[model samples]
Target: MMNKTNKILIQWLSWPIHVRIALIVILLILFFGELISVIEPKEFPTAFDGIWWAIVTVSTVGFGDSTPKTHAGKLVGMVTILIGASFAASYFAILSAATFQKQQAYVDGEIPFKRKNHVVIIGWNEKAHEMIQSLRAVKPFKQIVLIDHSLKEAPLMENVHFIRGNPTNDFTLLKANVKEADAAIITADQHKNELDADMQSVLVLLALKGINPSLYCVIEILTEHQANNAKRAGADEIIKTYQLTSHFIMSSYLAKNGLSTIYSKLNPATGNSFQVLPVPENLVGKTFKEASIHLLDQESILLGIKREEEAKMNPPLSYEILAGDYLIVFSH
Candidate 1:
């Protein structure tokens, strides 16, 4: 009979997590209430008063409104104080740990099977961080999943999900929900040599496309030659980082050392932000000068139009706007 009861107790303990917690909590309250009621029957004239005192003690409220008066009752209260403190603290600690465990699971990339239409950024670096910051400024609510191996803890930031693993692994991409991602960005490793980093980006791009052929993917190529490789790996856009920066930096000398001003003016974070909005349908067939004139009323200065494959900057006044073209405007 003892062995059968022992087996039953083990089975009860092995129940599901919520059930176990419920059972433990219920036991904590009931056993303490029954102990106090039996110790001093007058203090707790009824079971309800016993339960009430137990709840007040265990919750750390200690209202002292219905506390015991007799010596045995006081001893029971002292026992409640000792055990209740630990139970009360452990109760909250368990709750906090459970919440933290869920967050840690997300960091380990264990429970992102439902993440869809979110941005997947592979390879965290300076540029990748800047991209994330820019994204936050532009779209405060956009979901961005950061995949990296070096981070020990998930970034404690809102709208940012963390996945810790090798960026080139298809399994890691799967954990990031690449198959349903809205877009994917691959940044080269700033710590490695340019050639090695660019090749790594290419490899990551290949894995991304392999998992989701239709997912829009943009990759950074540190070396000019690796741009071709990245493109061949099915990258929708290959950003030649060194090449673009070098040209842009050199071009600024033409403005008499106005590089800082030029960069600030072009960057959205510095107040002189550039934005691309859909051109009004009524202005589709209108000339650039006419569109600019009308756009002045909206407090936006038309800089150019983004047509198929490229942007036309400072085009002739007679240039006709095409349908489906985006207007590049400057907003202060």
Candidate 2:
């Protein structure tokens, strides 16, 4: 039984730092009492008497259960009291520090995008790279940040920053600055089950709304039901990827035209290929004809106009440009 007790004491000593520190302090008081008894037998006549005295003094119980009789013994008891107080204070300090670190990490994870100036990406996946490429083509100079955990690289672009954590984490949402983003594009990560992707997209939308009530949020969904859910999550726009892909594919098949052109333009090998240019707010009063002339001069073709709530593909030359219109231009 004595050996067993020794083994248990050793095991406790080997525990984590905080645990060991606490144990060491308790043992220190015990050892001090025992040593005093051995050197000055009058201080503690027996092991039971020494332990009883320690318990009463350290606990401030002062039960009068046992009392140190020698001057040396009383001094040892005083030292034990100080040690116990110090250990209690240190324990609380360590616990408070740990708690603060957890709270700080949560704050860092919230979406950081703000200012109606940065690109806000919601979901993360293999396709995220391609989506980012598209955004780059449209707004090469804009700041782009990604919000997702699965991505080891949230913002792969040189000017981009990554949230580097889960989208649902509130801190992750604030870190992305969801409120100040120029536009938020939520895409589903590539997954075998389309439903899972849709759910993630919806979750991102919900997180964004909680952070910024007025922030523009776009979500991608695989099904109609998912789309409805995304809308309920406060998404301003929800794109049904499969449905749109089917439409595009069917149209391409009927026309006997391959999607290669569409693919290459959106996924250009050259960095200088297809691009999206936001019309200068100052140029909003200009007619589309003027914008077309400017684009042609730059050796680019104007494909369409993207406004606050409307995307007009292949708008007429006479169409009037607005302050926030994003002109879709294709260049070499």
Candidate 3:
């Protein structure tokens, strides 16, 4: 019998601290309730009445309807108050501390993301910040994860999880749950020179693809020479930042209202923007002219066709649209 009792005690000690504290409080209440009933049999007629008085006394909610009539019962009430109040205070204090610690860990970017199908953005910059804001505006509930090595605290944003670590590191990518992510955008690191930044972006792409070969990656390349390298490293789309900027600058210099027209058309907030859609079943096996006419009827203009990985702008009217082809249309 003694050995069985010792084994039970050891198991109880192994329980969580909060569970132990809770059990002790309950046992004290039951013990004092039974003691008070025996001491003042007339005052607490039923066992339930004794338990009620004990609860009221411990909580300091004395209703005065039930009270200890004898000196012994009053002494027992005092003991219940002291012990119960202490345990209650300890439980609440521990609960508050735990909640605060969890919040602190999240702000410090120490929490690992567990959700799937989120968009991962690598490197923090003005471009990334703008992209996040734009994505939030378009899809308010889209999940986004930001990975950066230099940040000391996560950015305060809804639906955005932050992982503070080197983007090129495999562990960091895993922490962001990149293996299950839908897509990733690797922005050029602003702190490095043009060539070095491109190289770093390519390295991050390689790490991301190594973990999830099916992950769609869009990377920004500053130098023209590194564009091919980024593509070879498993980047689905490459954004040539310098070349795009140069085209816009030259256009603005040549035309009086070049950017104004282009910006207005590109802005989705203006109720019209470019949209990539799958080729409709009816459009398959049809000529480009027929596809353009069909899109025109729907208040859209067919700009180009994306076949597999290659995109052709304004293909010849006789060009045939095949199944699995995507259409790039300017829609209203």
Residues 1-332 of candidate 2: C-alpha lDDT, one tens digit per residue: 99999999888767865676667667866776676667557757776666666656666667775566677767777787788657746766776886786555434443344544788776666566777877676668778787766654334356666676777777766667666777778887775378887877787778778888888877778878888888778888778888988987887888786764765554554544645677876568887888888778878888889887677997787899987779888887
Residues 1-332 of candidate 1: C-alpha lDDT, one tens digit per residue: 99999999899878755556655666777887887888778888777788889889877888988888888888887787787766677767777888898867976656565668899988777777777887787778889999988777677667888888898887788888888899998888877999998888888888888888999999888787898887778889888889888888778766667675656456555556778888789998999999999989988899999997799998999999988999999887
Candidate 1 CA-lDDT value: 0.82
193, model 2: CA deviation in Å?
A: 1.8
Query: For model 2, how many clashes?
Result: 24
Better of 1 and 2 by TM-score: 1
Ranking by lDDT: 3, 1, 2
Residues 171-256, model 3: lDDT tens digits: 89999999999999999999999999999999999999999999999999999899999988988989999998898888888887
Give me the overall lDDT of model 3.
0.89
Q: Estimate each model's TM-score.
A: 0.74, 0.48, 0.84
Per-candidate clashes, comma-separated = 0, 24, 0
Off by over 4 Å in 3: 1-16, 33-65, 258-273, 315-324
Report, for every candidate in turn, its global Cα lDDT versus the true structure. 0.82, 0.72, 0.89
